[model samples]
Target: QGVKVSGKTVTIGAATTHYDVSTDEKLRKACPALAHMASLIGDPAVRHRGTIGGSIANNDPAADYPAALLALGATIITNKREIAADKFFKGLFETALKEGEIITAVSFTAPAKAAYQKFRNPASRYAIVGVFVTKGKDGVRAAVTGAGEDGVFRSKEIEAALAKNFDAAALGGLKVPAKGLMSDIHASADYRANLIAVMAKRAVAAANA
Candidate 1:
């Protein structure tokens, strides 16, 4: 599902990312990983019909939506009520959406600085540690996807560091806890935890650039 702001339109599709028309760069800037993943969502035919809303509502852990949505502090407009991005995503492939509540639209406030850094597995291209950073009205937010087995989560360590210094040097001494990080064939929990710091630093560097 995808919603158009100016025309107040919402559409659903089986494919992902919705590439038939050009996406707003400002929106892309709000969530860079989504912008990057849009190209890989599917082939030309699929790109023509895929929708970001559908993927987000679906909440695929490996998908790119959760990180961007959370980092950008997007608002999920549903039939029942509006939910903040932080509260919208509940777990792997789950959301706050009720049985009959459908997403009407999603709106994100543009950020002054933002970037997405991902360490993709070679075969699947899924992020091992996807970090999305944003400096917005609410301050800095760091969202991590693919590192947590439970689902996407905010990286408070990185956020606190960035909030204090807003630079790569700020992240130099911070350590991301490995407690709940994901581990599998491609990487161990320690590796993913390390990648979180590396990606966060990269994201900060990119944002500053």
Candidate 2:
């Protein structure tokens, strides 16, 4: 998912306070997860108003962009330097952005195959448990969002399973441990852990289909 700020079209510079990357035809084709996740952000208004840069920069625990960025191995470009997605996210509502540095755009190389599945909070449309899976030249990557207490994180277990065989059946009987997951009024940590496995399976299935 790449973020470029412009008035009405995609560009490298900033003029408009916000730009909708979700509707970009090229982006939709390159990374379906970007379009899918963006469409699921709140409702129509939020989708149109929220910028991709704004969402990733905020790094909300339940935010969708972070998971996509991590799964796709995107690069976060700033005024000062570029940061890898794995290193960009620091913690809950935190990032590696330095003072006076602004995120100009993000560059993501679309995976050979990828899909995202989310169990969302009905009212807010935010993911209570979201999983993004990608299988490409680098390998298989499984990233979970809205479930980590620290924020989005990669699931090694799911990734390992997918690496062996990129199919939903390969993940059968495998589970992500509940440790370090978020437990709140919405869903418990253990429940989120379960959702991670289920969502990952669905994501793999979708990618294969």
Candidate 3:
């Protein structure tokens, strides 16, 4: 399955086991940078078979796809209808995808610049605070995942700062609130909050580079 956005429609295809890149060549062709970026998602087995459609459909709060999808302003395309990435993700392991709604594809306008930074838990390799930043014609958007205890979220504070100045130095003085972040044996809420800043800075540096 894949997602494609055209005009106001965001279409999501149903997930399947097949690992044919040809089926979703449009996604890679349209966004080569993102395609090159996708190669870094996981190990060989994951890249060979793991589907973007499957990833988005799952909407795992700790997964990396949701944050990049949201930050890129991609649309979630389903048989039922198109949903904005911002609206598609509702909460932890939750999305607006209704019953029987199959995601066909996702569409993105391509960012002027974009970058993703993740601090992984050694054991799980899951992001403690994954930050995806995109600078586009509209402005800069920062989507954060894996940090919220309740669900994935956007860092408006970071977005605001980046919008004003798209640089790491711009966020130097900003603070990420520890309230509402995740805490568990792997990491504490404060740790995650601190990572948000660290990852944000790294993401900015990467984008700039």
Ranking by lDDT: 2, 3, 1
- Winner by TM-score between candidate 2 and candidate 1: 2
lDDT of 2 by residue, 29-124 (tens): 666666776777788777656777788889999998899889988788888998999999999999999889898877767788899999999999
Question: Which candidate leads in TM-score?
Answer: 2
Worst lDDT 10-window in candidate 2:
8-17
lDDT of 3 at 122: 74
Instruction: State, as a TM-score between 0 and 1, how close model 2 is to the true structure.
Output: 0.91
lDDT of 1: 0.75
CA-only RMSD, every prediction = 3.7, 3.9, 3.5
| Model 1 per-residue lDDT tens digits across residues 59-162 | 87766668877998888777778888899999999999889888766767657788788888776666777888988767999999888988899988988998
**What are the runs in model 3 whose C-alpha is more than 4 Å off?**
1-33
Candidate 2 global CA lDDT score: 0.82
lDDT of 3 by residue, 58-141 (tens): 888788878888888888777778888889888878889888888877777867778888887776566777898889888998
TM-score comparison, 2 vs 3, better candidate: 2
